[model samples]
Target: MRLIISGGGTGGHIYPAVTIAREVARLSGNCEILFVGTKHGLESDIVPKEGFAFATIEVRGLERRLSWQNIRTLCNTAGSVWNSIKIIKRFKPDVVIGTGGYVCGPVLLAASLLKVPTMIQEQNVIPGITNKILARFVDKIAVGYKEAEQYFTRYKPDQLIFTGNPIRPEVMSAGRDEGQRALGLDPNKLTLLVVGGSRGARSINNAMFEVYKHFSGSPHIQILHVTGQNEYNSIVSNIKQAGIDISSGGNIIIEPYLYNMPLALAAADLGIFRAGAVGLAELTARGIPSILIPYPYAAENHQEFNARALERHGAATVIADKELTGSKLIATIESLVENPAILSTMAEKSRESGRPQAAEVIARLALCLIKLQSNNKR
Candidate 1:
């Protein structure tokens, strides 16, 4: 099988696209894959590293209100579609998939217009404008959140599938003990993993100083805080100024970034995060309950919607970014870690909400789309 997968901008979109491509290649045996994204998007950096043939097109997102920029973007989109069509014709993919991004807008539209089997993955509870517009054109939608169905008002029921979000297989395969050893954690104590996506959040970092002070010498719990690369030096400096040890003997372990994140997820009993769909998927797959502070400036405030879904399902707690403070974070952490019954309940709910097999499900659906489309043409 020959396939083309397109998704871009953020890791949330790019990771799922990568996972699906990998899964499809594994299942199909003799498969060839091409990844289409914008040179400016994160996918350009990521897709090539995954060992797939990568191609780029020019595309930009449209602004919501009437503006000269929106007019220019509409024209650019037309050019992107033409470029996507040329790529599609050259690659001659049997199936085309989009995991979610503005880049997918052009690629999927080109594939559909050419009568190729095509699908898009929507990863947020509140669908982004790009995915919403492409819903009518794409052959199918693999949604990460079931609640997202309400927002995608135009599609036929059969076209929508609740496949959850695709995650790296390593996230599921890593074990707690293995993770503990890898990250140098105490297996006897409850572990709290605090992260603000890959880039780190300034607000979250600022709010964490008191958490460090509060739990400095706790025997029952340990905090593993991934501080993100840019903010690490400042945070460590601040922590040291506050008289906390930055050495290995301390209860709090601070990291700039985690290369072995699957192992970290395996070791974590709880998490503090920024509600990106992919990150939440990995956390839930491991049954780690969390405290989420959604990014206020996200395109549609969709991170809050993502966080609230987990909260409603009893898997997490939501803290607005504006309201986040060191005291509030510490109290929230204490509330869960202090109550084993509540934490255990939340963990169970998180596990129940997880879809570890989502990658396979989406892969199967993509292959089925090809078969169905082929038979239709015959």
Candidate 2:
């Protein structure tokens, strides 16, 4: 089997595509896979690292407002459609899958026009513009949240499968004792895990600074803050300037980034982070209660919608990015830390929302689609 998978621009899109690729490779032995993504997305670095052949096209997202750059973007995007068609003709994939991003638009459109079997994965409660537009042509639609089903109500039932988002296997394997030892965290004190996605949230990093500054003398709580790769140095330097010693604090551990995120999630008692689909999925998968501050500028304000889904289930609490402050954050952390019983309750609820079999379900659906498409072709 030859498969072409297109998606990227964020970890939310990339990781799910990677997970499906792994599943395809494992189950569809000897299948040749190619990834199509933008030259600029994290996929350029990540796809090849996973040992998959990757090709890039210059695709830019459309601006919502009137601007000169938007006009240029529209032209480039049109050019990208031609570029995608060329790639599709050259690759001649048996199946084309899009995990949902602007990059998916051109590739999936070209594939559908070419009569190639195509699929898409939607990771938000409110589907992004790319996925929403491609739904009419997508042979199979795998959705992360059930709330998405209503949006695609116009589609045939068989085409819209409620397969939850694909998650990393490491998440399913994280263990409490192993995670604690890996982070050198004290087993007794509460460990608050702070993450702001892979790119890091400037607001979140600033909140952490306030956290360390206000609670430096408190030995009861330990913090493991991931400042993102871009913000790490500045955050560290600021700490130094404040005469705060991170290494000697004995209660705080700050990292630029974490490749071993499952371990970090497992070790954490409570989480403070953005509520991107991937982040929320991992938190729920690990049954870690979180204080989610959604990215205000996320497309369609979808991150808040995702966070509220978990919040409604009693799995997490939402603090809008605009309202999130150091004092409010610190108070929230302290309140949770003081009440282990409530934390336990929230943890249980979080676990309830986690569909551990999400990836496996998505993998099975992809296989079924491939088989159905193959049979139809024959």
The Cα local distance difference test for each model comes to 0.91, 0.88
lDDT for each residue of candidate 1 in 1-378, tens digit (9 for 90 to 100): 899999999998999999999999999998999999989988898889889999999999888799999999998999999999999999999999998889999999999999999899998999988888889998898899999998876778899999999999999999999999999899988899999877789999999888877787778889899999989999988887888664644678999999999999999999999989999999899899999999999888899999999999999999999999999998999899889999999999999989999999999999899888789989
Candidate achieving the largest TM-score: 1
Model 2: CA > 4 A from native: 66-79, 217-219, 245-248
Clashes of each: 0, 0
CA RMSD, predictions in order: 1.1, 2.1
| lDDT string, candidate 2, 1-378, tens digits | 888999999878998999888887777787889999988899999899989999999988877788999899878887888898999999888889999889999999888988888999999999998999999987999998888899999999889988777788888898888989988988888888999977789999987878997766467788889989999999988888988766666788889999888998988889998988988888888899999999999999999999998999999988999998999998888787788898899999999888777777876776777788779879
Model 1 alpha-carbon drift over 4 Å, by segment:
246-249
As a TM-score, model 1 comes out at: 0.98
Question: What's the TM for model 2?
Answer: 0.93
* Pairs in clash, predicted candidate 1: none
> Ten residues in a row with the worst lDDT in model 1?
242-251
